[model samples]
Target: MVLEAAVLYVKPGLEKAYESAFQQASAIISSMKGYRSHELQRCLEVKGKYLLLVEWESLEDHTIGFRQSVEYQDWKQLLHHFYEPFPVVEHFEKVDLT
Candidate 1:
């Protein structure tokens, strides 16, 4: 599995709206190939900061498939504007657990 993580810094007072947007926009990615699941988490220390985690069967499903699809355009329209600055997305692979 591939884990995609992003740190979203929403503008102040836009947390609820952003979260709602995410809830709706999540469907776009969910419909794509190799999609597994996703989670959105709010930060306790930072009021409008959120953590977005998406699981995919492989990195190509996200980096190539999802990005090239029309659904990604809608995904950007729905949720990208809510962030103050664009979030940086990174991927990881599970190695081991203790």
Candidate 2:
């Protein structure tokens, strides 16, 4: 599985609006190919910071499958404007610790 993560810094005073938009945008990503699950976490100390974590079957599932699809355009349109300075997304692979 691939873990896609990003730290979203929403513009001040738009936290509630951003959350609403993210909720609406969630459907766009959840319907994509190889999508497993996702979570949006709000920061406790920070006013306009959030953590977004998404699980995919593979890296290509997100980097190519989703990002290259029309759904991504909708996702962008719904949530992009709420960001103060675009977030940087990264992917991770689970490590065997046992």
Identify the leading candidate in terms of TM-score: 2
What does candidate 1 score in Cα RMSD to the true structure?
A: 1.3
TM-score between candidate 1 and the true structure:
0.95
RMSD of each: 1.3, 0.6
**Across residues 31-98, which tens digit of lDDT does each residue of candidate 1 receive?**
99999999999999989999999999999999999999999999989988898889999999998988
What's the TM-score of every candidate structure?
Answer: 0.95, 0.98
Report every candidate's CA lDDT.
0.93, 0.96
Off by over 4 Å in 2: none
The local distance difference test score of model 2 is 0.96
How would you encode candidate 2's per-residue C-alpha lDDT over 1-98 as one tens digit per residue? 99999999999999999999999999999999999999999999999999999999999999999999999999999999998889999999999999
